[model samples]
Target chain A: MKTVYKKPECIGNKKPNSYCPGCMHSIVVRLVAEVLEELNVVNSSVMFAGVGCDGNGAFGYLDIDTVISPHGRALAVASAYKRCNPENVVFTYQGDGDLIAIGCAETMHAANRGENVTVIFVNNAQYGMTGGQMAPTTLAGMKTTTTPYGRDPKADGAPMHVCEILDTLDNPTFLARGTCTDPKNIIQTKKYIKQAFQNQLEGKGFSLGEIVSACPSNWGLSPLKSIDFINEKMLPEYPLGIVRDR
Target chain B: MEKVFMKGCEAVAEAAMRAGCRYYAGYPITPQNQVPEYISRKMPKLGGVFMQGESEVASINMIYGAAVGGTRSMITSSSCGLSLMSETIGWLISAELPVVIANFQRGGPGIGDIGPTQQDYFQATKAHSNGGGRMLVMSPGSLQEAIDAVFEAFEKANKYRTPVYIQLDGISGGMMESVMMPDAISDEEVAALKQKAKEEWAVGKMEGRERREIVGGADSGLPLQTLNQKLEAKYLEMEKNEVKYENYLMEDAEYVITAYGIGSRFARAAVNILREEGYKVGMIRPINIYPFPFEAYDAIDYSKVKGILSTEMSIPAQFIHDVQIAVKGRAPVYNYSTSGGVILDAVEIANHAREMMK
Candidate 1:
């Protein structure tokens, strides 16, 4: 009788997502699309997609002007876009490796310069696109394809806390960490993302929402077990909360 | 237009600004640092953006972002810095984004000294980036030519939806010369240009149009093949329509000297000295290094031409490869080169030509 719920108007080109079962990328993409539509900035937003599974994931489904940036360069690209088209909402959807490891300088500098843009950071704890290798966010003593025995602090170092790292900078207007392991966390994560986009619209400086995601195929666990792994193991290292909101 | 004495780097920056370049992101590299310094001071006054990126990698990607937004954007770097930007250059090529790049080239191989060298002739004209990407590379020999090339570069970049490179050297970048300054593009004209780009291909506020997607780097298999073929067609078109060269004292000559950039100045001087000595030497300088002025070489008369000498400020002669390809063994091609910041002397170049005649 009444039209209560439907797909996010921004998520056009109806095609099946290519993310693995239990992977959090699809949920995050939908949340972002819904936020863009809710803010009525879908036509004015440009998505700078990072290199990784997120590249294919975001570019494939998001019915918006998207630019698939070179590996580890999305933030730099987004910063330029925002500077040029200050009226348009610009954001980068990047993974742990793309944002934290290879692009550490760009990430830190973009945050420091306080570029008016949003960053959607997906932390899956391992390199998912390139066969589950060790990433900068890989937990200490976590076994991965490269670190089969376990990530050694001496060899691999501890996991990087992006929100904490960015917290030290005074330029960022919002910095929060949330997960998509369950409905409650998913809603919270969407709020963080929506706030990041709001910061851009308000001409507030750089905002980043780190979504602690799960990798079922890479973690060598079932989809259900991977959710448990994120809650029990990953949550302690990368605690969920707002690290900065200035 | 009043002629004013200006350094090469400053001239380039001013030329870009006049050509409607509203956004610039560059790192401070020797011989080209003046470009960013000048832009940083003047860009704000013009209501344009100028950012000194953390690295060349970030700066080029920033240009990528600005270009995608339909803004006129540019970046400048030297040898090692240009090498740092090669990755994103490849991405820009694949994405077919329009951006201007200037390489005030220095000695290379690895962190070579910050002095003039044509060592990057191959890097600029042959392999700007990986994946067989080609840019319309222009070699500007003088300050006036440098300004002209920057204006031409932006026009061609937007027309073809591809990156355009200005291949300069430290000598051209550091030298001071009197040049006529062109009138700046009004803010209204710049806005109209950007609007045209957005309506055509750039990404921003789709506004009742189909959403635009600019994808690069990860293409594989058949899609990559299709992209390569499309780019090849564009490059071929550029070759056909954009080939530019200067034939100096070439008619009724027995020996022809070939060069580009600052090396062309040296060759021109050598040609003058040879003509005074009654050796009948001339010069052919390529303006667009990628399209490469092969037709000029093909037009040379083998019957009267004794030899074609290719001279550049690089070891093992990088620019000569193209010269040889152009000559196609129609005449003897001799290469005389200097490397690692050494400037070629006109007398020595003339002596080399004289020896070829003997």
Candidate 2:
């Protein structure tokens, strides 16, 4: 058999991943690195890692230059970086809690202004880094530490569909929702990640790929069960597909 | 260039632009609104960015981002706005990013008024942030010094790889005075400076160099103690080299009045009044509030001094604490203050100093 599927050189191969097993953060980070390498922008790319398990993953895992933004402020930072250094490609890697909860205004404003940057938003339905408290994206009936009795739609509010929200914004050049569970879906997610980055590289303003991810340890399930949870429960609510493209 | 009459807020903003600041982000607030307004009109013409952030919180973070990207970035705000930015300021200090901020202070514990007050001295010098982060806090007393301070703030910020704060009261911010502008720094100069700094320290591709990991606070991968020790050592160095003050007319004086910024201006007037009346009085005006002119206090000739008087535009006199500590009981310290946006009365301070002499 011909040797194929070698790791991207942009990956920090010597270090062990700090993410829990079944977490999609490592997979998403690798895909981003691979896309940057493919586009020949790995050297020019800068990643703003927002505070979360995924945020911490960037420093040791991604060989590219990385800045860990204060929780929920990655987009604001990425916006500044892109405006200041227009030649460099900028992107933000953020989780559900970081992007939506404390950082809601930053997310909305960056998208509204059509800043030239990519946002790889990991929606894991809970605050994975801070030990799985309830998040803005936590499912309507899911049981989180804060929502131990299951999220009540009346008391709490519905799960936010990030792609749908960004679709309403006129300036965003591309918006897609993807999930990584089965092999086929993983490939599809990588494609969306590539396109979002291509948007930034092409000077297409404001692109975001919302990856419906899994937090196995936080969800109190085995790695396999988490995959099933994403497929059965998350797919119906989030509905993986492109919500906007121009 | 001939001196031009300019508002203190606008002068500081123009000075920052001349000093090669390419990015400015701020929100509209009292006593410092001219800063953002001036930048909004000027930055586009300068081929720079001026973003009115959603709030002071967002503005400081935007500066953080710009600073991390190795641009000369700054933010301007008043007391309440600065209070909102304190968290990001601490993070900037911890991350060791170079950024400049101007706090054109208004009267406040909360929304006091849109006028000059020295109420934020303690907040600026003592409790800037939660993690024991120290900023190079420079307080400018004149429009010329305000412009000069803005220029020097960037140099000090980039030199130390830390945030440098230019603390001006509303008087220095809102008052109009003639200022001689510095030579404009060319766009090419700014770009070259940013490129050089980026190559040396910014978060970017390693190329052939070792990977750079930018961190702040206790999270820079070093043990907590080691990181703190490093920060402490840096602060000690700042204290030694960065102590700045103006010893105004202290020679052969029987009484010394201590103040900073607008308060200093008033105190100087008070000193002049007492001197004309044949009472020996002088003023010690601290230009840098952080490594505050403690040595300037020690340099005072105690044999001729009757008592040290602290004059300020704050209710309970915040700057007096530092004066008392610096004097170390060699002379009693008296406080005369006018607060809540009420400008300090020079004659009242003069009378107080005369009484102390008696």
Candidate 3:
């Protein structure tokens, strides 16, 4: 199989990301970068970087009017900036842990409020930043540093289906969850991100795209096996698709 | 000026419209929501935009957006909604955006009750958001004051490029009374004012590329001497442009009472009682609290006034600090306050004043 080298302009100069070797974080990061460059929004749009590993999101790899927020706090900050300065396109790049865990309240409220902001939710089943801790999106039987015996719904709470919860909101005008695990999903995920940014530019409110991710080291698998886990395990639990569209 | 019997909330809305405010965004909450309901219909009639946002947080934010777009804008909400908006208010203050927020205060440490109270005094003034920028807060006593305050608030916010607030309670907000309305400025005159707004907002300007000027200050930590100079000039201009106060019946009165907004209304009723009983008393209501009518304090006969009675709706209360600043102990200052649930009554204020006199 052949792979496309990272685009020169899309090269995230920050460093090779710490994501697992075969991790799609690198691919998604490049795609988002290319889209920003393509849309000519790279310099104009203010990127509100989220918490956890995605804390330095925005590829953290570029020069932009970036505002890095405390964990789960990025959306509120981004929405506020956008609300105050609508001419400046604002969006937040977050993760399952950042958007779902401590930040859930702000996440749900931003969607419910239909704030004219864009959110890129990176959902890897385990906490990649702080050891491979089980995340809110961890599948029922997913094993992790915290849930060694395989998650017991009786012992641990059920993973919150984020896109579904967001769809329940009347204000979240666009909701799409895509994966970058393969060639096809990678193409689809880029399309979702481009649309999200376009909606924000057009003053459309509350658009979000969740990118389901993988963890090789934490899942006790090689880079190749981690892709299989996301495909076989994470896919069945958190399916990829558009949940809401206006 | 034509007179109309109006609730405090409605008067606030009318005041904004009269001030040439063309944009308003808010979500419905009790008490202050009436301001939005009235203006939303009235503004479009006059070719303004009234949008109901999805939530209080969003509504306030939308106001921020509109303000940045160089339009006169406002947002209104009660306690819970205001809390939700506190973070945005910080951003507004930081960005130095010009806008107005009408906080029709309600009870609570959290959703305590939507009933009337002066509980948000601390939040209104101090919560100007931990960024350390002083936001001017105006409290009005009568329907006229509410209307006038709303108009004045926009002007002050624009001049200073900071958020201004009209702080009142349910009693102050819901009460119905008559007010002398300002004559409408012709749409052409407004268009002229809108045209001049370019002087402040670059995009609104008629000529010149978007220029970022730098001023200098000695202690400004800003090495750009010119940038500091510009900032100092702006602050000096604001000092002259801002700060308003009202002094009523203070002359020859031994005990002068000081209050604002609903608290002033309570103070007025009490003052009437004392006046009818032949006690020498008067009231001073602060129309603007940031520039803080420093002149009002300078002009008063500190010796003639035996004491100053401070009344408000919060637990720690307010304006007493102003008393210290204005009077500086030339006269005694006494305070009366009720927390969260109720507006302090006329009788209570009168009693507090009578006791202070004794």
The top-ranked prediction according to lDDT is 1
- Report the lDDT of model 3 for residue A193: 90
Instruction: Let me know the DockQ for model 2.
Output: 0.65
Q: Give the CA lDDT, 0 to 100, for residue A118 in model 1.
A: 97
The local lDDT score (0 to 100) that residue B275 gets in candidate 1 is: 86
Model 2 lDDT tens row, A182-230 = 7898899999999999988889989999999999999999999999999
Quantify all predictions' global Cα lDDT against the true fold: 0.91, 0.87, 0.72
DockQ score of each predicted structure, in the order shown = 0.78, 0.65, 0.10
Best by DockQ: 1
Q: What is the overall TM-score of model 1 with all chains considered together?
A: 0.98
lDDT minimum window of 10 residues, candidate 3 chain B:
B211-220
Residue A79 lDDT in candidate 1: 93
Which of candidates 1 and 3 reaches a greater TM-score?
A: 1
CAPRI tier of model 1? medium
Best to worst by DockQ, what's the order? 1, 2, 3
**lDDT score of residue A152 within candidate 1:** 99
lDDT of 3 by residue, B1-358 (tens): 6888887887788877777777787888886778888987798888777777656665665565455445677788887788887766766665566788888888777887767887776677555555444577887777787777777787778777778887777777787888888876677876666556536652211223322211101111234454435545655565576667777777767888888777777788899999999999988877766556667766768667778888877777656776678787778778888876776899989998889988
**Candidate 1 residue-wise lDDT, B234-347, digit = tens:** 999999999999999988988899999999998999998888878788899999999899999999999999799999999979899999999999999998999988999999
